[model samples]
Target: MQMLPLNMAAVTTVAMWKAIALIGLAVAEAFVVVSSSPRERSVSTQLASEYGASARTRTRDDYIDINRESGGPIVRYDGPTIRPLSNVRAPSLDEIWESTMPVIVQGGSLRTWSFANPQVDAVQVLFKSEGRPIDADIDLWNGPDNTPHKMRVYVEDGARRTFSAIIGTPRGPNSIAVRNIGQLEFPLDAVVRPDMQDGLAASIASVVSKAEVIQGGSVRTWSFNPVVQSVAVIIKTDGRPLNSRIELLMGPNNSKQVVEIYTEDGVERPFFAIVETPEAVGSVIRIKNTAPLEFPVYASVAPYTLGEYNFVGDSNSFNEWHML
Candidate 1:
């Protein structure tokens, strides 16, 4: 009788241990399944039929849609005769602006130039690729809406020069085109406002009374930019410790901007000046000179529009640029 009881207890103990072991294993497997959950992936197709035409579903079908678009740059076109897109990933701002030139496309993929509404389809890239750029052009067009528009583009001289321009609203979307019969002499270096200034240095004069204060962001690494080649930055001390700098920014594309900081001592080295952008309309360069370190700084811009037009030029703790 005693032996039978002992044997029964032993069998029960073994079964209990087996059950606990199985339960532990189940818990472990559950943990592994949860930990190894796959990440949610987003779609990136140039012309996916699902962009807006279909009810695209996300694995994380959270109703609150988010615009977490991450992928290579995109450039597309649509018109009476659309051609296959070329390999234009994040093309230079100058390249895109060239399409705005007065181009009369007669046949093939070549059509009259038109400034595509960047806010809708693309972001006007203002700078070219890395290195000194050698390619350039200008495209012109007549608006299909009985208006005319013009665009000037600085080739992605990679890094040869910095080109920048600021247009008043009157020169921008105000009208399709400015029908001024007369043309101005560009070779004289007398740049016009609101158009592509290619590569030149001009002053806004004393706009302090007309200027507004802009709060700045963080500093970033020092990188070269094609734009802002020759620039004169005039800052009002306004009783602050913020020292301004001249940066050789390329574009707002990939890679951080490059810079050649000029101080009151003047530019220590010769800044290679590329004239007549896209072509040498009359390219020229001036040897390095003293950069004004006065309360109001002055810089000369040329080459192409430096990548970072954010005016985010700030000083680090020690006065070095802090790339934001």
Candidate 2:
């Protein structure tokens, strides 16, 4: 065979092509390795990083033991851990204003109770039936403002029907009246408690980062940064009240706490829950509204240093309060 002189330009082009191919191959391999890593495989881990959750582990001392007793019914601590206002105390039914009224089928009867103290902020209504399901239409009135506050038309079956409403402002006196709308007659029990704004305000560590508007029949997730001890979500509709389902998920295992809020034709209401301890991976809050109307929502996460506290009086006391 006869040898021919080499073309340097052609040789250089081939060499460059070879180098580019090798570089591309290396980059593809790196991408595959990163995508298949254990950390990247976890959706929660990725979400935590995206939300700026701290990876550092928290010490036991960082948390306050609200329920120190070791071996009874394990009640997890949720809410703000901080000390409440000086005047704030656990809600009590003993010192509340309560009254009972007979249910009238035709023109619903009304029972009004006067509050000597003007600090009452919550009202609870319980319906007692005589061996049958009772249906009633209850209306709450703020006597000082002379305006109708909350109204509920519900059926009380075997279980005792208890309804609670939060009063936004302090009033001189209020009255709740129930009318029998169903066939069965029942007695209505109403109780009122003072507002918990002072205690709840003292527990809030920071305002919500942002508010998200979600359409009806849709679900949205809110991730917290620097995981909080507790979270309170305020859901507001334009003019009608709707039912909402909330889920709180924490840790790598994604432990869940669920809360459901059902309201009538009202302006706004709040739903609150808390985690026993802070999670390094942060927490995920999911809200689902099944109503036909869209609404606006915002969540306030309680500070880790102190959990929020509301009056947890008798089993029937309305404890949760709006953040003022």
Candidate 3:
């Protein structure tokens, strides 16, 4: 038999090393399964024992080591004010007579709303071309007080957004309508006191992302509330194609940092994909329309479906998901 070349011998040695490593890993895994309580030995346990050497765990306080093998985001809820929208059973926001902010235009003025004890989340202000004036559910995050919230009017379709600068300065009913949004419940401090003339302690903060809006849905929504201090949705469609803009509200609506996306058509299709879950802080928004119509509200809230999710976080009041 011809002897192997020098280079070939080196290659053989490397391959042997790799093979040995793989075998070692397999053996470790088996040992873990064999060592664990027979009843407790599961696929997860076996894999963990074999490759993922137990980090450390002691009976005392410092003895317990957090094994982070999942390599996913560390889901945490430590915010002071946080909760779900349904906790307080908010009166489904159908109509709101908000006090619009004062604005000096070409000839008239508009008073933007300052709701009493303004508890709003998934809140919006939508306008109807045919029905009574629409309401825009503008989510207001926490921020410095006395800031102005503004929206330029126009038409939109699909992944496109257009704004028609009102010929010159904007005006009345013909002008775009503005109102405070309300969903399952009023968010923390989103309400104004009966005594205070303007928005109470509720200053705008960072708004959550503009949830997925594929099929023709447009409206402002937040991931959490301040009062109920939880999470919820507030969606309003104008029949035409729409794109959801995730607005991060900065102090008194001083302005908005916006992020947007379209939704999957609920009528004919359902976008199905098991998106690898990021850290726990990330929100997994699955907007599925169970009904055929789209107007006032959306289908039932999730979690209740699999009888898993829909619970307050262990630490805070924000919404928490459960896998069934």
Cα error, residue 247 of model 1, in Å, equals: 17
**Candidate 1 lDDT, 1-324, residue by residue in tens:** 435688899999999999999999999999999989997665677567475445565443333222235221111112112111112232233444455442221111222113443322111113233343322221222233422212233233434443332322221223222121112211111112223222211222221123223233222222322222222223322433223322332234321222222221112111122222221012222212122333332223222322222112121211232211
User: By TM-score, how accurate is candidate 2?
Assistant: 0.36
lDDT of 3 at 296: 23
After the best TM-score superposition of candidate 1, give how far the Cα of residue 4 lies from its true spot, in angstroms. 99
In order, candidate lDDTs are: 0.29, 0.45, 0.28
Ranking by lDDT: 2, 1, 3
- Rank by TM-score, highest first: 2, 3, 1
In candidate 3, what are the lDDT values of residues 26-83, reduced to their tens digit?
Answer: 9999999888845653556677765545444433333312224544223322432222
lDDT of 2 at 300: 40
- Give candidate 1 regions above 4 Å deviation: 1-125, 139-157, 160-162, 167-324
Worst ten in a row by lDDT for model 3: 162-171
Identify the runs in model 2 with alpha carbons over 4 angstroms from their true place.
Answer: 1-119, 122-193, 201-206, 225-227, 251-255, 265-281, 294-324
Distance from true location, Cα of 309 in model 2, Å: 21
lDDT of 2 at 166: 41
What TM-score, over all chains together, does every model reach?
0.19, 0.36, 0.20
